[model samples]
Target: MAPGGPELLLIVGIAVLLFGAQKIPALARSIGESAGQFKKGQAQVEQELEEIKPDASGAGSAGAGTDAETDLES
Candidate 1:
């Protein structure tokens, strides 16, 4: 289902042909930054979901607003 080594190499070769070797590093860096931003957003959403759910004792959601404010302030 996933690409093997040769397929990966072929993909890289195509990328090189399209973008050229000199631009590859910049493209990779941009992709890396985008991926990082995506991950951070995903983590924030998960944390918010956790805050919204009641605890084991069913005490109800707590501190969700304050946490948002903290994130905004930082």
Candidate 2:
């Protein structure tokens, strides 16, 4: 679950007290940039998984269990 409004305000107030008003903006900006980078990396990994999904899900996979299937047949 996410934090409530009061909790959020309290966190922000604590941050302001700890970092001061001027530094808060810079800190927030850096946090946003880091989150964006994280999202981009996540998207790239998801894309790679999608690209590999078809290969694993029946595409060119028929031959993969050929030996196992033959062993079972015997």
Candidate 3:
């Protein structure tokens, strides 16, 4: 079951008590920066995958050439 208002309030209160108001902003900023870095890394990986995809197609054509050479040798 989902938390109701009181439960949500209690959780927030606990967070404030543990971290204090002054620290919360810094914590949030760090989390935002981390998330941004994660997104940047994910985009880099996607771009690399796109680049490799063309090489994969080229490899298939190269394999076909090898087969042709084998047939000529036979």
Among these predictions, the greatest TM-score belongs to 2
Pairs with backbone N, CA or C atoms under 3 Å apart (clashes), candidate 2:
none
Judging by TM-score, tell me the better candidate of 1 and 3: 1
lDDT of the candidates, in the order given: 0.89, 0.93, 0.94
TM-score of each: 0.70, 0.71, 0.65
Number of the top candidate by lDDT?
Answer: 3
Badly placed stretches (over 4 Å) of model 1 are 55-74
In model 3, the Cα lDDT at residue 5 comes to 100
**Candidate achieving higher lDDT, 2 or 3:** 3
In order of TM-score, best first, we have 2, 1, 3
lDDT of 3 by residue, 1-74 (tens): 99999999998788899999899889889999999999999999999999999898997999899999999999
Superposed on all Cα atoms, the candidates' RMSDs to the truth, in angstroms, are 13.2, 4.5, 5.5
Candidate 2 overall Cα lDDT vs. reference?
0.93
Clash count in backbone of candidate 2: 0
Which should have the higher lDDT, number 1 or number 2? 2
Per-residue alpha-carbon lDDT of candidate 1 for residues 1-74, written as tens digits (9 for 90 to 100): 99999999999999999999999999999999999999999999999888766564354234666678889999
